[model samples]
Target: MLSKIQNTFILIVDDTPKNIQLLGTVLKNVGYKIIVASNGIQALGILEKIKPDLILLDVMMPDLDGYETCKRIKESEKLKNIPVIFLTAKTQPEDIVKGFDLGAVDYIVKPFNSSELLARVKTHLELKFNQELLQTLLNFQRDMVLMTDGEKVIAANYSFLKFANCKNVEDFNLKYDHIMDLLEFEVKVEKNDVSKLLRLPKEEEFKVKMKRDNGEYLIFRIKQNVIPEKEVSILSLVDITQLENQKSSLEEKASIDELTKVYNRTKFQQLFKNILEENQVNPKSLCLVIFDIDHFKKINDTYGHNKGDDVLVNIASFIKSQIRMSDILCRWGGEEFTLLLVGSNIEDGVKICEKIRVQVQNHPFIQDRQVTVSMGITHYLPNDNLETFVARADNALYLAKRTGRNRTERN
Candidate 1:
């Protein structure tokens, strides 16, 4: 692919026939394609049709001179990036400075050696080639990428523009003074602080959340690389929102009962442990209620297991709706369930349980038959542990069964 580098077109814009011929020959001999123009106006006209890799411009010309010609070329958005080299006899320091100020990459005197001309042409063309190659690579990436010189963004890939909903660089510049301004940092960087972003440690990686035009926020993993010699920083952002969502989904699936969509037994144990720890540190009124269907086995045997499954689901849904968000409800295997009411005493527990019990007794289940639940309530004590606390609730549940079928009992 590097062989294509030699095929780059060079536009020679000089009034003198001899100078154009000499420069064309020198460049063409080195495998470069050359186009000739007699004056600055002709060169600008040719530019409208063809974009060249480099322009050999002459300071002395008729109508529009080299300085004005160079200024117009730099002003044009399409032609500005093309390197221009001034080939002229006017070798004064001021003349050279003017060419550089007008955005000429290099200035060559008229009596310049053929070897020197070839070397300068090669250097500038190679630099432009490498820059284009880098941009192409950046555009191919799935991640958004931007290159900045600490104050403003100099280059950005197509992905970055699409992610920002920007049509082009000009549109991006209109909305943001700096690229960091668009980033909602997870931590550090003091909210749109470009200085801190530039000085971010090489080993540290942070996250930024960006809101799209569609009102959705995307999370990105941001990494910065600095080119110390040029003082340019390249920032690349990878979208990680989907991955985070998948992880959260897996964690929730692990804790939820598949049939009823309620907390499973294992999750209940874990939460109950945390509650005990917190109560030990700061005491609070807490109650444990263990309940189950009055005749779950009979329901399954009479109406089939599928209908029994429906009954369990309806009971869990009703219980979940009756409790506060702070309360915990778990399917404690089969038709049995456990509820932990945070900051609730035995009285509050009884009140909530009675409401659920009454709702279950009146609510129609599968086949429109009446359904009821028996609950055993117990409050936490200062000396209680997991086994003792759960045993008391279980024992109360046994008594509720011993005395009657559909009722709430306190232990």
Candidate 2:
């Protein structure tokens, strides 16, 4: 139950003073503000200053006729949506047809019925108000929404313009085939079946990879619903790029040590088990190397825990730089690190461990002092489980520490 005559603005363009005065009085009495112009030139001038909801255009005006004025109004982007009703005395069929062709919504003949004129004006004003409201709602939506008739774009929301990198409606060159291009990554529907999908009453959601204007691929969750009565489909797209990135960042954080930024114990174990499973199918040389900083407690006790942390961080960085991409490095515990070398024997493991020990011994640590690591290297045996395999490497590490502080031992 919406009010019909609520602060509506109407512009009257006619050469006759009596006609302008009569129409202005009738419209103003019905709660509509009126603006009058004696000719088309004055009307266009007034239009530049004020945006009216509707225009009452007289057909036979001096110089600029109603047909020409309506044509110019429709040609304008800003004033095009205003409903124009022709005020004319011509009753010929061609004359009426000509008025409509120039974008006139309705026509009132000379000696017009006041009731008929007001009724048409009220109806068109209400229709225009509803259209403006719909456009406003569409512009306010965050998700990109579009209406299509299975082949052409009928309407698009503001978010769609932003998504497509279009500044205005004129720049938006979207077609039904463009939608199919976006769906090509995951949803494989034939062109013929597109119409069938749009006829569905239920909403369908799809994860699609859409390439943006910046040449980056972003993930979007597209939801489509069909409006059978309108013969059009509504498509809403929610950009999930940030959500997907956050999920990936969380997964990466879970698998990495916060301090050293290398794989943690849990991730190392998972990767090691995967390698072992793969090795069982096709036996390949694999080795485990365990190492710990020598006299790490003394460094922490004398130089402070801050220096101890620096020592660990520097050692992890050095080790990471020395290892191959295939090798998995992990901070096993406080002051200790582990390496899993795939496609390597005990001899290869020992050689790599020796290089690490030498580099660590030569590198300057905190307080201008030097530090070294004792390492244990072990090759995978025929029937070695996780415990036994790790224990062998641990035993060798103990042997290296027992014999001397800065050396490598194999088991």
C-alpha lDDT values of all predictions? 0.87, 0.84
RMSD of each: 4.2, 5.9
Off by over 4 Å in 2: 1-3, 14-34, 58-62, 65-68, 71-77, 85-123, 138-253, 270-287, 301-304, 342-351, 366-370, 377-389, 395-411
Candidate 2, after superposition: displacement of residue 73 in Å?
A: 3.2
Candidate topping TM-score = 1
- Model 1 TM-score (2 dp): 0.78
Error in Å for residue 2 of model 2: 2.8
Please, what is the TM-score per model?
Answer: 0.78, 0.67
Clash list (residue pairs), candidate 2: none
- Which residue pairs show collisions in model 1? none
